[model samples]
Target: MTVPSSGLRSPEARRFLNDRLDWNLLRTFLVIGQEGSLSRAAARLHLSQPAISQALKRLEEQLQVSLVIRRGPRISLSSAGQEVLQIAAELYGTVSRLGPALEEPAETVTGRVHLLSISRIQSRCYDDFLARFHQDYPQVELEVDVLRSSDVISALLQKTASFGLSLCRTPQPRLEQRLVLQQRYAFFCGRRHRLFGRKHLNLADLQSENFVSFTSDQLGGNLSPLTVFRDQQGFTGRIVASSASLDEILRLVDCGFGIGCLPEHIVAADVQAGKMWRLPPGDGVSDVNVYLLWNREQKHTQAEALFLERFEHMLLTTELGERF
Candidate 1:
């Protein structure tokens, strides 16, 4: 049934009329508009190309408007389609918010929250926050996947993850981000290394040293902390080993293969036990910002809100806060 464009005055009446529109059609329309191609939209929606085309046709018929202009394999929104797109986005956002806005009391909240986070965060702070959140809301399931920073953003964009924690900044306008923590990355060496116990060392002193480096892929071709430090210090060193695994990097450093750059928190225990030594000042090391990101289109459920609150509190009261 088509919702007539006239005589809907009350908010509830508008909502009722909106309910008459096929949400599947609207979703398909939005995806096609965003992707600008039926095949891409079909891939994203996991539907056949012809099915996506049919849904768009049906949506235009229901709305009584020519929503798109098709030329060969390309698609572009008509003026009317642009207006409809705006309205559809607003409607979709409103519908998403409805669940949390009308949710029951906090104690009764239940459902799973899927979270994607960088592996560094998983290693450093995941356990403390997960344990605390579980203690408060035992019935709410929390599913977490540790991925690279780029993968975290990808999962958020795909809507496969409700929330993301990333070590890199999210440049996408569609994602909302908040600064979660600041982590200091410093150079470290095994106790057996020549410069391990040095009180002070110039940047040039380490120019010819071999280094165990973190993989550059996680940063999406952007500079890593080590690269940034190298540029700033004009060091001409070669990476003797590189890996995506932080454990492997640490092990390589501990075995006296080369100096490794890592977050201070990850190596605090090793430093305290004299297994490794942090390089002194003048190394051009700096703190990197970590961000918590989520799609603005996603509504917060009561359980998700509670989890965020608890997680924020934990971060504020712990060593993460101190580092920040």
Candidate 2:
């Protein structure tokens, strides 16, 4: 809380303000402001909506100012509320660092680093870093879950994941994102497709061919580049199938569902094994970047910090071309 120069100058007044303010109330208000809804903040904190409302009311009553303007079901911060939100965030950030600051360096820092990811990440640099990090920090338990790109972003926002590796189309306001890998995509077909054995084919040859792609392959979705590429090619065929899982998309394409755009490097084995064939426009394929994401406002443990530091160091030292 920010006090005027003459407001809390007396020790008694300072003690009164400090003793009356509840830290939990500040935390609840911060979440409410971040989420922009009492219900969403309650869900994030695993508390009831009435409880969250009561906390906000108590804090407002203590400060003698309405912190939020509620209309219908949504809520927005008032002018005073915005100032309090900033102070609360600063106070919370300071308090969150206290644990890490007080703890001395030990032989082993034991904690779990929960990582979320998109499916079938194919990178030599990522694999090598994982191997090295595991060897260096044996005591830190690592838990990973594969999810859709949207789900990965959601988990990071909810502070449920320590970090994520996924495709990103735009920047998120509350998260720190770093480009970790760039993957090239190409059109491919299964052996059952009519164009499988063609040797001399151009982009015009596949004009009316049916297409299959990821669920997020839309103009404003996570795979927007693929959508733009398809629109530019003037393909008249409809999307016959789509899936969120890369393996499922590959399987659908391989089963004659339709031609699909997939990462060239990841499907190299399938291309060689006769399961899939590369289509036209092989040399000038679109590249999508994979980002490392984490919530900037979330408190991180020493283990998570160490892992982030090591991974960031690797990214800084390695070349972009070498990541693939």
Candidate 3:
């Protein structure tokens, strides 16, 4: 491959020069480029600012190029730094693809792991999982992104994410899926609503009530649980408002706009605080099954495997997992 014009002549020459280059120095340089400050990059990499500065200096000496321009408290990438950043990212991707062939011991599975999930799952379910993972695998750098379920699947397919958590599973031959949990949903209303204090309430009783709808990418299309439940119950209530944010849904419900169907975990605190009341059990509302998805074609990194194992263990053995 032809090398870019970053004071480098040929690929073979660059490779020969890079023989003495340290991987840690490259990592430090990339982190500095991302954070744009030695202090911030040091904090992220769990090193002192002076150590970070030394690493950058060593990297510059090895490459024989000025990579960054440092000001009072800020740093900007030089043209050479930008070119090296792109090449370093490509190198990182190549190393990541080596997967289990490069696996070290479980305790030393050190690398970056990219995970994608829906907003609800990230906020409500994976917080504790993330904490435990970080505690056990301190060397592993975890990166997470919250996106829509469809977008999460797309990221997995495009190999942009290592794994994804989604609400629904699609039939793709090239993708593998495992059911993470089955989340039970309940109808909720603000404490001040007419049905808040009502006992023995059922789906029929909510027929004419206004409803707040939260959008989701379901199997068929973009539809809200309220819409599905309404159709299932043959209820004719109108949707007073719609939003994609769970916080907005709660706010709208708390303001007495309308009742909404939400996962039990989401409204648990609200229920305990008496801000929302759960309607009695009914048939229209159904449990949602969440799945973990990954590309079957990609090899699993040791860190990714460890994360999956710990996540599954937490899901099956913990209180949060028991709730499902």
Candidate 4:
């Protein structure tokens, strides 16, 4: 094979170097060039001085070019070494980023994070976290689909959803569940309802009043806490209307269909505007736990994994009251 007299440029020379060259040799040469002494480089690399010398020798022999000019006590780069040092620097720059790049893969995540959630999530903490997550990962597309809590769980179990936010009474098998928030549900009436603006009411006052609620507001459903609460309160009023969507339930209540129960914080602005009225027994209302759910067996995309991990970290660090 014809070989180049200088660098590994000729096809035979390149093949020869590729077949015999060791990356550790190039790394040792870089250290030797940086420190200007084989012994110092050895110390920096935690290798013996003789090992460093042998590594440099092997690299030079493979390239068929002397890479270092050794004096009595110090070392200097030959012209070939200078050129190779620059190349080594470029390669090292790339190699050095592998760790931090892996650590911060979220920055480069360029895909969609599809989340299934129940309707009318009214948590400022959650909204703020999503806004910041978006700002940090601008390349990630976020898609949120509203569904019933059970449907959210079902999607997650089916691996169709990247993550889930839902009201959970019991943790489903094959799903990892974390409590994200506990929202207090309160009775509210619209402007046209008889109980609207009525103050100093008790649980008895609402017993005879017709009610409207979520489709899951019954025993053995996701919102069973609400059902248990109503049963405990001796509420015998018939459910006049029901829907899976909170917006529709709110509209039904607003149209004087009947009283409805909803998260208070979600409709604070409406209550303030006299669009709705919060009913009595303000302290003993039922609180439903909203959970973050993910299927453990499902393989997640980079964006989905990053978003879920960060959101879980936020949940761990933030208090429930603040998140609520």
Clash-forming residue pairs, model 1 = none
Clashing pairs in 2: none
Q: Compared with the true structure, what per-residue lDDT tens digits does model 1 show for residues 175-289?
A: 8665567777788899778888887686677777888887762233423655766766776778888776678888889888888778887788899999998875534277776
Between candidates 1 and 3, the lDDT winner: 3
State how far residue 67 of model 2 sits from its true place (Å).
52
Q: Give the per-residue lDDT digits (tens) of candidate 4, residues 193-299.
A: 98888899988899888888899988999777778878887888899899999999999999999988888888889999989998877773788888889998999
Best by TM-score: 2
Better of 1 and 2 by TM-score: 2
* The 10-residue segment with the lowest total lDDT in model 3: 315-324
**Model 2: how far residue 255 lies from native, Å:** 0.9
Question: Across residues 1-324, which tens digit of lDDT does each residue of candidate 3 receive?
Answer: 122235656787689676867887887787787667898688656799999998988788767778887799999988899888767756665564465345564467687889887766634456766876787678999898887777888888888888888765444666766556666777899976889878887767988888886666232643445456577778788878867667888889988998988778778888899889888665427777677788878877878877776665444333334433
Cα deviation of 296, candidate 3, in Å: 1.1
Model 4 C-alpha RMSD vs. true structure (Å) is 20.7
Colliding residue pairs in candidate 3? none
Candidate 3 stretches greater than 4 Å from native: 1-108, 122-128, 217-219, 222-226, 282-284, 312-324
Alpha-carbon lDDT of model 3: 0.73
Backbone clashes for every candidate come to 0, 0, 0, 0
- Per-residue error for 144 in candidate 3, Å, reads 1.4
What are the models' TM-scores? 0.59, 0.67, 0.59, 0.66
